[model samples]
Target: MKLSVIGSGYVGLVAGTCFAEAGNHVICMDVDEKKIADLKNGIIPIYEPGLEAMLKRNVDHGKLTFTTDMKHTVHNSDIIFIAVGTPPDEDGSADLTYVLAVAKAIGQYMTHPKIVIDKSTVPVGTAALVKAEIQTQTDIDVHVVSNPEFLKEGAAIDDFMYPDRVVIGTDSDEVGETMRQLYAPFVRTGNPIIVMDIVSAELTKYAANSMLATKISFMNEMANLCHRVGADIENVRRGIASDRRIGKAFIFAGVGYGGSCFPKDVKALIHTSSKYDYNMRILTAVEDVNQDQKTILIPRILEHFGGSVKGKTIALWGLSFKPKTDDMREAPARVLIKTLHELGATLKAHDPVALEEARRLGLDKMVTLCEDNYEAIRNSDALILVTEWLEYREPDFEYMKKNMNSFAIFDGRNIYNPEKVRSKGFTYYGIGRQ
Candidate 1:
């Protein structure tokens, strides 16, 4: 199959590369000439664990290609995937300008019938909107399918190659069959391929991400309550997770949920509900809880230092939204960095992959981005655990005690045993442990 993917962003790049790896000829089209040129020179912009290697292999094998020529890509491919970014608008609804633009371009340039798949995460009725946009350009037969991706940033390749289930949304069975064929190789392990109406599929993506965000916010709230009640949220989470009905995943209590998906999706869902004059009460609270949760450690730090973090050198352990990916989009660490900086304190941060992104986000000028964990903690007043990277799980307590002016640690992710750290002659603070 010849597939053309519009947008070489995170989702588009991964999807196009994986599709090409699965024996399909894939042409990824993007408007950014510089980005296409970089890809042509085999430069991968983002850091996913195994993506660079796989993309390079596919590109070398001639199965995957990148170009800025939209007309040629649309004219050559049988399946056109609209995987452009739907960034949030002012009202919190997904901005559909890029998706709709691709639709119009495809309509103007397409010479044959094509299956236009929405590989990007968009709001409900977006497929219909894309369909309408393309129809307004030309009356050519086009089947717009909603195919939302559920790949996590760190484990995108595995998720794409071995999805738990594949959801294909289209009004016509003929379109569904074609999608099924495209995904048949991936679902060879007998995982189900769900086919449904296009609108439902679009809503499914938002609903899935929002529900996961709800879980994270709920857990963070419980963790905060645990701090007041002199209980450990970890134990409580363990007790509840044993229940068969409430299987454990995304239940870890932490600062909050942050990324490209959860924060935006939750807001978009709430906005959509408001459009119908319906209030999403639970999700509204979830959003509120998350917004506060991101800065949950600020008050603790202030109280510990007697209402002033002025002249404090805080060592930050992580800069990414979460571990194993360099993405810092909506990262809680950013919120903490800005708040701490406003308090007249200094920040020295370390992450396995996000140092460059921190520089790009201009956080490097505001704080010191270190290459190693020990370097981040050296000479700092306290150690602040943000992302809970696995390397920070165990550390040389002696080095921390000797190098720091104060033996204090504020754990936003609750990554340590409070008693154990206290036993090391240090005062340890966590989200919900007493």
Candidate 2:
């Protein structure tokens, strides 16, 4: 099948590349001429693992191409996927300006019937809006299918190549079958291909993200309670995670959840529910808890310094939201850095891959970005583990003790053993570890 994926951002790039890898002729279209030119020269914008190699292979094989021409995209493709971003509005609802604009362009350039899939995460009833927008431009028959992506940032290639389930939203059985055939290679292991109405399909993406966000908030809440009660969150996590019903996935206590998805999706769901005159009270709490949880370590750090981080030199072990991705949207480290900087703390930070992104976001003005992890801890008063990167899991404590102006370790992700750090002649503070 010939396919064109509009908006060659994260989702569009991965989806288009994966489709091409699966033996489909794919053209990834973007309005940015520079980006399309970069893709043509084998330059990928995002830093997703395993993506560059796969995209390059498909391009080398002539299975994939990049273009800035929308008319060519609409005319040559049997299936066109709208993978544009739906960033949150000031009121927290998803802004569909990009998605609707793509739909209008597709309608205007259509020469015949085509299948348009809503691959971007949009609000419920967005498929209807897309369909109506397209109808206004042409009388040619068009089938709009809601096929929301479930790809994770760091592991997007694997997730696309082997999805647990494929959800296709359409009223037509023919469209459903067509989508199933397109996704059939990925789900050969008998994972479900769920076909449902457009409304349910749109809601599924929000519901799935909100539930994961809820789990993260709930665990963070529990970790805070454990800290007050002189209990260990790790032990509590182990105790509860043993139960098969509440199996462990997103239950680990951390600073908070952040990315392109959770923060906006939770707010969007709450906003969407309110529009229907129904309040999502639980989701509202989930959003509230997550916001506060981002700064969960501030009080501990302040108290450690007798209510002042003023003139203290603190080292941060990680800068990204999580490991293996350079995305810093709503990263907890940003809040920590901002607060610490305001309190006159000199900051030194390092991440395996996010140093350039941090510099691009102007974080270098507030904190010194270091290339090596050990270089970040040099002469620092305390070391704080922020993102839980694998390299920070085990460290040379002897060197840390000798090089630091002070000896204190604040384990935000609870990846350290408090007893071992204390034994190394350094003070150790861990979340919910007592």
Candidate 3:
């Protein structure tokens, strides 16, 4: 199969590379000539574990290719995937300019019948919109399918190669069959290939992400209540997570959830609901909870420092949203950094991979970026574990104690045992652990 994935962003790059690895000839097309040139030269922009090696191997084997020529890519491929970014608009709806632009280009260049898959997370009915836009350009037969991606950033390759289920949305039986054939290699483990209406398929992506975000918000709220009641949220989380119906997934009490997906999808879903004059009350509260949860620890830190963080040097470990990825979009660490800076507190921050991103975001001027975790803690008043990266799980606590002017641990992810840290003659604060 010859497949062309438009927009060499995160989704497009991963999907194109994985499809090529599965024996399909893939051409990843982007309008950015510089990005295409970088890909051709084996320069990957993002850091996903195992992606660089796999992509390099596929490119070397001639299974995968990159191009800036949209006409060439569209005319040569049987399947076209619109995996472009649908960034949120000011009103919170997904900005469909990129997706629609790709669709129009496909219509203009396509010479034969093609299956166009909307792999980007778009609002419901976007498939219909894409189909309508394409039909205006050419009379060629085109089947627009709503095939949303469910790839996790850190584990995208594994998720693509071994999806729990594949959802294909198309009214035509021929289109569904074609999509199933393309995804057959991935679902060989007897996982379902769910075929549904295009609208349902588009909504599925938003619903899935919102539900996960709901879980994170609910746990964060529970953690807050636990703090007030003098109870441990971890104990409560463990108690409830044991239920068969609610088997644990995103129940950890963290600062909040942030990434390209959850924050955008939740806003988009709420915006979509509003278009129909319907209010998604639960999701609205979920969003509110999350916004506040991102900086929930600020007050605690302030109170601990006698109501002023002025002239204090705080050590922050982990700048990315979560472990194993360098993505810092809407990261809780950003909230911490901003608030601490406003309070006139100095910061020494360290992450395994996000230092370059921090520099790109101009965070270097606001905080001291350290190459190592220990270096970040040197001469700092307190250590705050923000992202819970595996490297920060266990460290030389004695050495950390000696380096810091004041020994205090604010465990945002609850990765450390409060008792163990306190045993080292240091003050310890974990989310909702009394």
Candidate 4:
């Protein structure tokens, strides 16, 4: 299949590369000439585990290519995927400007019948909007299908190569079969290719992400309650997670959920509900809980430091929202950094891959980026574990005790054992840990 993905961003890059690896000729198109040039030279913009290797291999094999030519993209491909970003508007609704713009361009440039897939996460009924926009450009026959991506940032390559299920939204049986054939290589393990209405398919992506965000918020709420009741959230998590119905995935108590998907999708879903004159009460609470959860450790840190963090030097072990990816969108560490800086706390932070990104985001102004994790803790009053990077799980407590101005560990992810840290002759504070 000759496929063209419009928008060489995270989803487009991964989807195009994976499709090329699966024996399809893929052309990843972006309006940015510099980004297209970078891709042609084997320069990847985002960091996903195993993506660089796969993309390079596909490019070497002549299965994949990058281009900035929109006319060539529309004319040369049988399937055109609109994988652009739908960033949230001020009102929390997904702004469909990019997706609609791509649709309009495809309509103007397309020479023949084309299957346009909505690969970006857009609001419900967006497929209809995309179809209408394309129709207004020309009289050419076009099949607009909704095929939202379910790829995680760190594990996108694996998720694309082996999806749990593929959802295709279209009214025509032929369009559904065509999509199924394209995704057949991935769902060979008997995972279903669910074909449904366009609106349902569009809503599926938001629903899935919102549910996961709800789980995270619920666990964070539980963790806060445990802290007040003098109970350990870890034990409570273990107790509940043992039940088959309450399986563990996003149930671990963390600072909060953040990324490109969860926070945006949750808010978009709530906004969509309001548009229908309905209020999503539970989802609204989920959003509120997550917002507050980001700053849950501020009070504890202030109280521990004699009600003031001014002039205190704090060490942050991680800067990214989570491990194995450099994405810091809505990261809880940002909240901590901002609040602590306002309190006049000097900050030193380190992440294996996110230092440059932090610097790019101007976080270097607020927090000092260290190349080494130990270097971050040196001479700091307290160490806070923000993101649960693999390296931060176990540390040389002896070195921390000797190098720090004072010995205190704030475990935000609860990755450290309270008894173990306290045993090292240092004060330890863990979220919901007794």
Cα-based RMSD of the predictions, in order?
A: 0.9, 1.0, 0.9, 0.8
Displacement of the residue 316 alpha carbon in candidate 3, Å:
1.0
How would you encode candidate 3's per-residue C-alpha lDDT over 373-434 as one tens digit per residue? 99999999999999989889988999998889998889999999888999987898888888
What TM-scores do the predictions have? 0.99, 0.98, 0.99, 0.99
Query: Which residue pairs in model 4 clash with each other?
Result: none
lDDT of 4 at 107: 93
Q: Which stretches of model 4 miss by more than 4 angstroms?
A: none
Question: For residue 261, what is the lDDT in candidate 3?
Answer: 92
Worst 10 residues of 3 by lDDT: 424-433
lDDT of 1 by residue, 272-307 (tens): 889889999999999999999999999999999899
Off by over 4 Å in 1: none
**Steric clash pairs (candidate 1):** none
Which runs in model 2 stand beyond 4 Å of their true positions? none
Model 3 whole-model lDDT (C-alpha atoms)? 0.93
TM-score of 1: 0.99
- Tens-digit lDDT string for candidate 4 (303-327): 9999999899999988888899999
Kindly provide the TM-score of model 2 when superposed on the true structure, using C-alpha atoms: 0.98
Q: What is the lDDT of candidate 2?
A: 0.93
